[model samples]
Target: MKKVLIPKRKLPWGSDHEAIIWLMAVLLVVGMVNVFSSTFITAENENSAPYAYLLKHLISMGIGFVLFAMSWRVDYHKWRDWLGPVALSIAALLLFVLAAGTVVNGAKRWIYLGAFSFQPAEFAKICSVMIAAYILSYRVEHKLPINILNAQYAFIAFLFVAVEMEPDMGTACVILGIPIVMLWMAGLKTYKLQRLALVGLAAVVGMCIYQPYRLERIKVMFNPWSDAQGMGYQTVQSVTAIGSGGFWGMGLGQGLAKYAYLPEAHTDFAFAVFCQENGFVLVALVLLLYGAFAYYAVRIARDAYDVYGQLLAGGIMLLVVGQAVVNISMVAGCFPVVGVPLPFISYGGTSLMMTMFSVGVLINIGRYSRAKQAKEKLDELRRNNLKNHEAALAAMPGRRRLQRIK
Candidate 1:
């Protein structure tokens, strides 16, 4: 057998998990290029600086990265202890937004804070995950029934309803998706998981059944080009830009769709801008990057040192990848457009910052994963040595003689 060495471990802003760190870096760069392309036309039309959106996105990314570093350095265990108050705080913020949110494009999802406005729904998604994971991990550990109607799951349901009331059905789905995925992966039995799924399905259906905007979106998903310039206009434009990419894309920054043709080019439909500029080949590459990131993120979750890390990291993996899938599908017209931003690639400051913060949490969990195997081995060695020493003492002639005398 080979000897093992345990070195002092440190988290220095960058993760020990290089795959996640580099993948995020590449995606942020891609976001900058595509965000500029997507927003330049909108800025120019508004008579703002052509790079204004790009600059704002940069500042947002900067702030997000700082919080990312902070989260990475902090211990993941603190979240478990803080879960309840954090959940209540997030709930308060959500209510505050609902009560005071500024409307944009007919959606009441953001609150104005002086010169800046933000969507609390974005941060609420992460908060929901932390809360759900904390509760579910405990349930799994204690062999409690992971029931859907339970208050733990009800908190998630409450969040979903709050976001849906904001009419941001896209984000509402994600807030729900992350927890459901986490619950299933945390080893909730099939029958109970099924119940949770059914309840979730009912909630989703009920939320959508009465909304006119949602109904219109569903109709557009099937034949987006039918309306050409009305209800289907966004889908039509997105598909047009993607189809125009041909074999090698229109070349970076050369796409025509972002010239005020695609309304949400820098946000929900960012992938379309990327497809328009980078072509099918590079578009596939971007998807592959997301794929690889998801794979490694899951690897981190599987190898984590504890249940909390597993649930926390796994839910985040679902949150980022799930949101990406929704945005891509929406752009491709396979699903109706809702306001889900491509993780790490969208133009929204709050969205980008919160996402980075979550990624930081994932990275923190991964750091323990990297050192876990070696640490476990060392622990096993110490246990075996201690047991052997105790046995030898018990068997010693003097110890036996003393026990007999007593």
Candidate 2:
């Protein structure tokens, strides 16, 4: 098959249409400071340079920018052609990591490559969105009968199964939920979607009961004092860090929790460190930035030129927003200890790159939407001018005939 060349248009970088970019930039800068505060102390105590932790995160940010810029240059619609293969590659990577991954804190989620490690689950979240967007776009185009046993739904279920078996339940849920959102946005009826939701709620309940660890985490959430120094330690530390903030934080780099008190200060529980170091005010600012990002993403999805672009942007919006909620909930003690990281803010290279890439796609959708609107306005004006010109030409014929007769 011949490849189609998607013409690239120059986008106005300073336009308000790109508000998410500004929000993301602020979040990224704040995350760098928080990661440094959380990780540098530990690195320094171990005779490593204080900037070692900061350097790694900065490097991830640099790489993420490259991915973002590259993604923006391409038309997101092209992915529809081979989203299946892309998704299969991500799923295969998930399985591969499960079999030959680096074991850290009893979970084999990381694939190490020389000096750095990457989490396949992180990229899988974005891939799930891409796959779902493709399938939903196809269904909407063909007006397929999408019942409970639909093949597209089954295929999406398979992706969820692979992710869940990896034991990364949080990411698995995000991956599954994003597609549901995309399907809804693609014009699925509410009653049909409600049935899916009911089933999802049942599955959540069943999983909590079946998985002892998940149930234990729930118990720990309700009564942090019960386990104290056991399974509940992370929760207790996180709560204490939040409570200690008290309107204003202990100040950056001065958080007591990072001094060997809180575990996973740079990864799963990074938000707790953020709260401890930056206080409620800065935390509020971060939340505001997140809200802005969500708002613009939804706008992009709403304004996209076609169903495919809309679904793609909408699916990605769900992934980022859903992950942020899960990560923040884990930190705020509202949910069980799910090891999900804040998007663009966490100290993981894979997560950062995937998120930035998704943002870049949304930017492309916004650009296309704007361009299409401009073209429509121009066409409308041209049509109006042609009609007026035709009226003038008709009147001129009558005048000429009258003058000739006279």
**C-alpha RMSD values across all candidates:** 5.1, 6.9
Q: On residues 1-406, what C-alpha lDDT tens digit does candidate 2 reach at each position?
A: 9999987756434443478788788788988888888888889898999989889888889999999998887887876676777767877887897788888777778888998788888776777777777777777788885454666567667767776876778777887777777776777788999888999889988888777788888888988889989988999999999889878888888889888899888888999988887889988988887887788888888888988888888887777877898889988888988867898777888888888998898888888788889999999999999999988777787879689779
Residue 344 of candidate 2: its Cα lDDT?
A: 75
- Stretches of candidate 1 off by over 4 Å are 1-16, 381-406
* Whole-model lDDT per candidate: 0.85, 0.82
Using all chains and alpha carbons, the TM-scores for the candidates as numbered come to 0.88, 0.91
Error of 1 at 127 (Å): 1.0
Q: After TM-score superposition, what is the CA distance of residue 322 in candidate 1 from its true location, in Å?
A: 0.8
